[model samples]
Target: MNVLITGASAGFGKALAERLVANGHRVIGCARRLDKLNALADTLGEAFLPVVMDVSDTASIPQIITDLPDNFKQIDVLVNNAGLALGTEPAQNASLDDWMRMTDTNIKGLMAVTHAVLPAMVARDSGYIINVGSIAGSWPYFGGNVYGATKAFVKQFSLNLRADLIGTQVRVTNLEPGNVAGTEFSNVRYHGDDDKAAKVYDGFKTMTGDDIGDILLWLIESPAHININRLEVMPVAQTYNGLTIAKQDS
Candidate 1:
């Protein structure tokens, strides 16, 4: 199967791309960073096709959809994983820039990619879409604000698309994970403040990108009759976002 993954420069996207290639699947990965993409291509050998494309840039999507090499013409899976959280602050105190960025990337970018690829999938009546959402969508927090709202949109959109594609071979699944570790997600959200961002996952083990990658591969390889609509995976340490407690030394 030919697979396309967005935001393949780092984190979940990169891990997923590596796993798919290792399993002998042809993979096409897109990201804004050429260096990372090139490195991925080198590491994955001929199984990986790395493209420099930004999911937030909708205008360039059509060309990407049309210009796939012959080997990737029959794309069986698309992973919409190009998203992030910006400033962890209350809505009232947050930067408008951060809000816009989140909405543009999480919502608009997702729509653009789906619009570009869905028609072909629908025409053939065979494909799987794995949207990497967040538990933040189901449960809100003090500083979740726009980021949470964007993921909420992802959850709803996945359901609506599944409804619209009923009876067809296409499958849409929303994979929501909580508190993943070993990803630049926190650093990006904290605007490159690695030290400040590191505190969030300090106390215990958190889900790794490979964990999410394995789930994605499973969803696509399942029987055509079965559709895993929604899944939420998190480390035991991340019971729930609302269960926070302050510790006091006696």
Candidate 2:
């Protein structure tokens, strides 16, 4: 199978690309960092095609697909993983720019990629769209703000796709993971504050990229008749906490 993974330079994307290629599947790894993509290509060899792309840039997306080599043109699996969370501040205190960035990458970007690829899938009546969502989409938390909203959009968009493809063989699944560690996620969220990012998982054993990759592999290899709608996972160390409330001075 030929797989296309966005944000494939780091985090879950990189790990998934490595795993898929290792398992004898050809993968096209897309990211904004050309050097990083090239480095990944070096390690994954010919099976991995490195394509420089910024998912937030809608205008250039068409070209990315058009430029694909003949062998990699027909993407069997589309993994919408290019997304980020910026500024952990509450919505009122959050930067509008950060919110817009989140919207652009997480929502618009995913939509653009899906729009570009879905037609082909529908035409062939055989494809899989695995969206990398977050538990934040379903469960709220302090400072989740726009990031959570964007993921919620992902979760719903995935379902809507399934609704529209009722009779088609194309499958859409949303993998919502929580507290994943060993990725640039926190570092990016904190805007390069490595110390702050490190503190997030200081003592906790969190989910790893490889773990998510394993799940992805399983989803892709599942029987054609089976369609796993949504799978939400979190490390055993993680769980929901009770809601918080503040009382006024009595």
Candidate 3:
């Protein structure tokens, strides 16, 4: 199968690319960092093709898809993994820029890429779209305002795609993972404050990119007739603590 993964420069995307290539499937890894993608290409050899892309840049996505080489043109699987959470601040105190950035990459960008790829999939009547969502989409947190909203959009979008592809063999799955560590996620969220990011998972054993990669492989290799709509994952160390209540002045 030919697989295309966005945000392939690091974390889950990189892990997925490596795993797919090792399993003898061709992978096109897309990201904005040419240097990192080149390094990944070197590591993964010919089986991995790196494409420079910024999902947030909606204007260029269609052209990039059109320019794909013959071999990688037919993408059997599309992993919409290019997304981020910019700030941990409450909505009232959050940066408007951060919200817009998240909206661009997580919502508009995913829609653009899916729109560009869905036609071929519909024509062929076979394909899979795996969206990397987050638990924050379903279970809200104190500082998870816009980021969670974007993921909620992803969750709903996946289901709606399924509805639209009802007659075709195309499948869509939303994978919502919680507390995943060992990724640039926190660092990016904290805007390069390494110490602040490190403290997020200080002593906890959190999910790794490999874990997500394994899940992706399983989803891809599952029976073509069976479509798993959604899968929510979290480390055993994590669980919902329920809603918080602040007592008003008495």
CA RMSD of all predictions: 3.1, 0.8, 0.8
Report the number of clashing residue pairs per model.
0, 0, 0
Residue-level lDDT tens digits of model 3 in 1-250 = 9999999999999988988988999999999999999999999998899899999899999999999999999999999999999999999999999999999999999999999999999999999999999999899998899999999999999999999999999999999999988899999999999999999997879999889888988898899999999999999999999778999999
- Give the local distance difference test score of model 2: 0.95
What does candidate 1 score on TM?
0.95
| 16-44: candidate 2 lDDT, tens digit per residue | 99989989999999999999999999999
TM-score versus the correct structure, for each prediction = 0.95, 0.98, 0.98
Where does candidate 1 stray beyond 4 Å? 241-250
Each model's lDDT comes to 0.90, 0.95, 0.94
How many clashes does the backbone of model 3 have? 0
Looking at candidate 1, the ten consecutive residues that score lowest on lDDT are 237-246
Candidate 2 vs candidate 3: which has greater lDDT?
2
**Local error of candidate 1 at residue 151 (angstroms):** 0.1
* Greater-lDDT candidate between 1 and 2: 2
lDDT of 1 by residue, 93-195 (tens): 9999999999989999999999999999999999999898999988988899999999999999999999999889999999999988889999999999999
> Model 2 misses residue 157 by how many Å?
0.4
- Indicate which candidate wins on lDDT: 2
